[model samples]
Target: MSRIEARIEDLGLALPAPMLPPGNFKLVNVYGGLAYISGHPAIDGSTVLVQGVVGRDLTVEEGYEAARLAALSIIASLKHELGDLDRVTSWLRAVGYVQSAPEFHDNAKVVNGFSDLIIEIWGEAGRHARSAPGQGPSPLDVPVIIDAIVAISE
Candidate 1:
C-alpha cells in the first residue's frame, strides 16, 4: 500500500466506494494541479449513516462523526479520480455544511471531524483553509456535507 493508504489503515479507516452524483454534475474536476471535489454526505452508496438536525435530533458529537464520514466519502472520490491517494500533494481548502437547529452554533467543532482525519492521514499536507457553515437542512436529510480542494502531483 502507498504511505497514505497505510496511514488510513493505521487509523482504522478504509475508504468506501466512490459515490456517483445523484444529479448531472460531475464528482471531481482537475485543473492546474488542483482537484475540486463536489460536496458529499455521510453515506456509503445510498445508505445514509447519520441524519438529523444538530442540537435538535442529533448531538454535536454525532454531527462531528457525520462530518468525518462525509470527508471519507470525499476522499474515496479523490482516490477514484486520481487512482492513487499518494498523488495528493496538499489539501487546499475544505468547506463543511452542518444541518443545524436554530440555536445550534457549533459548526466549526463539527467540521473539525473532517479536518482532523485529513491531518491524520497526510500529516502537514492535510492542513488547509476551511469553512464551516450552518444550514437549515441538507440534501437527503443528512447531518453533514463536505467538499474539498486538493493539490495533486501529475
Candidate 2:
C-alpha cells in the first residue's frame, strides 16, 4: 500500500461508502481532468455524528473532528468510484461551510481537519485553496458541511 493508505490503516480508518444522492445529481463526476464530489453529511450510518453550532454548544476542536469525519466521507466516495486513492493527483479545491453561532467566526480552524487530511495523503499536491465560512445550519443539523474538487489521473 502507498504511504497514505498505510497511514489511514494506522489511523484505524476505512473509508465508508459515498452517500446516494438525495436529488438528481451524481455523487461524483470526472470531467476533463477534474473530479467533483457532492456535499456530504457528517453521518455514520443512521446517526448524525456531530451537531450544534461551533463556538456555542460545540468547541472549535470538536468542530475539527467533525470536519475530519467529513473528509473521510469524501475519501470513501473517492474509493467507491475510483477503487484506489492513489489515482488522485491533487486535492484541487475545497469548499467548507461550518454551522456556527452568528457571533462565531473561526471557520478556518474547523476546516483545517479536511485540509490536514489531504496534506497527509498527497503531500504537497494535496494543498489547495479552500473556503471555510460560518453559515446557517447544514442539512441533518451537522456541525460542518464539506465538498471537494480533486484532480486525478486514469
User: Best candidate, TM-score-wise?
Assistant: 1
lDDT of each: 0.90, 0.83
* Candidate 2 lDDT over residue span 49-154, tens digit each: 7888898989999999889888888887777787777888888889889999999989999999889977876789899999998898678788888888999888
**Candidate with best lDDT:** 1
Q: Give per-residue CA lDDT, model 1, range 1-154, as digits (tens).
A: 7888889899899888788789998798999999999999988866778889989999989988998888888888888889999999999999998999999999999999999988988999999999999998678899889888999999
Candidate 2 has its poorest 10 consecutive residues by lDDT at: 40-49
Please report the TM-score between candidate 1 and the true structure: 0.97
Using alpha carbons, what is the TM-score of model 2? 0.91
TM-score of each: 0.97, 0.91
Off by over 4 Å in 1: none
Model 2 score (lDDT): 0.83
